[model samples]
Target: MKKVTVYLSENTYDVLNNLSSKRKESMSLIARKILEKGLTEEAAKDGIDAVTDAVRRAMRDILKPTEDRLAKLAAKAAVAAATAMYLNTQCIADLGKNNALELYQIARTKAVAYLREKDEEA
Candidate 1:
């Protein structure tokens, strides 16, 4: 762990203090938790990455790319990522991990679908 000094406004400090009291957590711990949650939320809300991905896909697809390009990319990326995971048995050790992978696949599928929807509008 590392110690760093951060200055917070009076209003923000008060909110943190109140939430810390409600959660029965120390102020420092509460602050760390809040920072982590904010990062996670920001990542979830990020549209720039999605926009960039869509633009690239649109460019490639527009360039008379081979068939199944999106599906091929998704399949390769998923298999590469999954092959890196170390599991002892054939069964999943944790359902959350599997769900996360599944969620990624669904998100990719939806992104392509939405991209096509947007293109139709344009």
Candidate 2:
């Protein structure tokens, strides 16, 4: 096997020294075994993390089209509701001499407030 030089902190060296004496093994052998085991565990953990990320990406990809479709449908529904509301308000509410533009703005403001109130309730 190839040789490698590594710097160890005083505490780490002391721990290794104690283990070597207790196990009757060389400090170099103990350090090597520990390093190998740590590397193996880290590699397995990294593999699991990689798989989890891939699954998350796959789920997002699968759900994206459905999300887009629902958003489009909701937008269409909102437009239809706004048009119907405007028509109903024009027929029922007294416009006096106020232009249709003013009425539209007023309706828009009311609609926004109503939506905000509903959102807060939810």
Candidate 3:
């Protein structure tokens, strides 16, 4: 067996001394047992941490493709909406000057109100 010296605070030494007296074991033996148990627990905790990190990495890898696909779908939807809006605007402009401005203003107001309502709901 290897031997190493450790210094303890007065209170800690008193506790260990009391425990040793109660257990009918030497202080060195009690300290060795405690140290061994601590080492075992620490090693087990480290193993669990490693496993948790591995699981998180695996989950992130598995979800990356789905996240990319969703982003692409969102971009496509935005483009489609923008194209539809542009086409609608062109149609309104061709409706002759007397009605086009008034119609566009009314549509803009309605769209703003709708967006505000949606925001509130969200």
For candidate 2, which ten residues in a row score worst on lDDT?
91-100
**Distance (Å) between predicted and true CA of 6, model 3?**
1.8
Q: Please, what is the whole-model Cα lDDT of each candidate in the order they appear?
A: 0.76, 0.89, 0.90
* Residue pairs with clashing backbones, model 2: none
Largest lDDT belongs to which candidate? 3
TM-score of candidate 1 versus the correct structure, residues matched by position: 0.41
Model 1 weakest lDDT span, ten residues long: 84-93
1-122: candidate 3 lDDT, tens digit per residue: 99799999999999999999999999999999999999999999999999999999999999999999999999999899879777777787876556766776788799888877845545
* The best candidate in terms of TM-score: 3
Score residue 45 of candidate 3 by CA lDDT: 100
**1-122, model 1: which lDDT tens digit per residue?**
89979999999999999998899999999899888899898897687789889999898788655557777898999887666543322233355455655655676689678867845545
lDDT of 2 at 115: 71
Model 1 Cα displacement at 26 (Å)?
Answer: 0.3
| Cα-based TM-score, every candidate | 0.41, 0.70, 0.77
Which portions of model 2 show Cα errors greater than 4 Å? 94-122
